[model samples]
Target: MNLIELSPEGNFESWEISRLKELRAEEFSKELGQSMLYENDEFRLWDITLKHKERLTFRRVVNDFSYTCITDGFGVIHLGNGKIQFGQFKKGDICSFNMKENEELILDVENTGLGILKFIVTELKLK
Candidate 1:
């Protein structure tokens, strides 16, 4: 997987961004075990928690231009019909997506030990 550290200037380096793209491409049908984070215009932060190092599977459907991130944990996110993107998420990580349609954001926790925080976007923005 391609790894990139957030830049001090808040802009990702060219090489690092390219590497992130590669990682996103290779994330077909793979289960991820780590903390997840995302943000949009209305909210500044959203944290998805994983318990006992559990796994979350991300699947992309090329024909539909959509993807799904399924966690046996807890979280909420806007779904859409566009090129799905993902990367290795850690504490303080953030990403944004454009919502083309009204989508359902579902949160499920398989174990009581897991917890998460979700945010919704009222305005369209990416940073």
Candidate 2:
């Protein structure tokens, strides 16, 4: 199962949290430039890193919800058709998000930015 830690700098929307926990296990993966995963059909976590020094925008059009936590560096989140959430971290901020199906997430990062980490958890499971 994928597990992640979210920053304590900001508050997350309650509906976002609910949606995140409802995401299915098979809907996540690790691909080029993106780190996504699911655990025992209970939890899902991933990180999307921007290795470049330039600002870039990330777009995902899936129902399974996703959120971003600033593990390192700085960034802003823009919600196009869905809700996007965030928290700030300096060098050691630990942030995480739960996943839900069919939720869109967009991330904009500055500099050689570190990616966001997310986690989705299912009931009847232990962390």
Candidate 3:
């Protein structure tokens, strides 16, 4: 998976950590995406779109989920704890993660590419 993982034990520079802490102080979304396109008893669907130089912070409660890239683009993944990463993805690329109980993932995403970066996230709610 192209997903980025962030932990205090991970290799992250001092400055990057500081910046992540700063971002954590700002507002962040509890939802997985910029917009909740749909939701029901079984799952929730979301849409996220980012123009060049756009950034968004999100607190993701870990669950089994998958997402599809809607456009080819590059971007920075910033964890709540301040780890920064640059990633490139194709238009059709898709990624998914399965979380056991008590696991959580949270981060900020910034679209650094010129092209619009978009994704559709499907989260399967636990029983």
Tens digits of lDDT, candidate 1, 1-127: 1123223322334323543464346544311223324434433222334454342334322211112223322332111222222233233333333434443222121222244322221222232
Ten-residue stretch with the least lDDT total in model 2: 118-127
TM-score of each: 0.23, 0.34, 0.80
Model 1, position 2: C-alpha lDDT score: 19
lDDT of each candidate versus the true structure: 0.30, 0.37, 0.76
The digit string of per-residue lDDT tens for model 2 on 1-127 reads 1222332223344324533343322243222124445445553454555543443343433324334334445443433323343434354344334445443343333343355432222222222
Q: Model 2 compared with the native: what TM-score?
A: 0.34
Residue 114 of model 1, lDDT score: 44
Report RMSD (Å) for each prediction in the order shown.
13.2, 11.2, 3.2
Candidate 1 lowest-lDDT run of ten: 76-85
- Candidate 3's residue-wise lDDT over 1-127, tens digit each? 2534433435456545555566556655668888999999989999989999987666665778888999998888866555666778788888888888988777667898998999999988993
Clashing pairs in 3: none
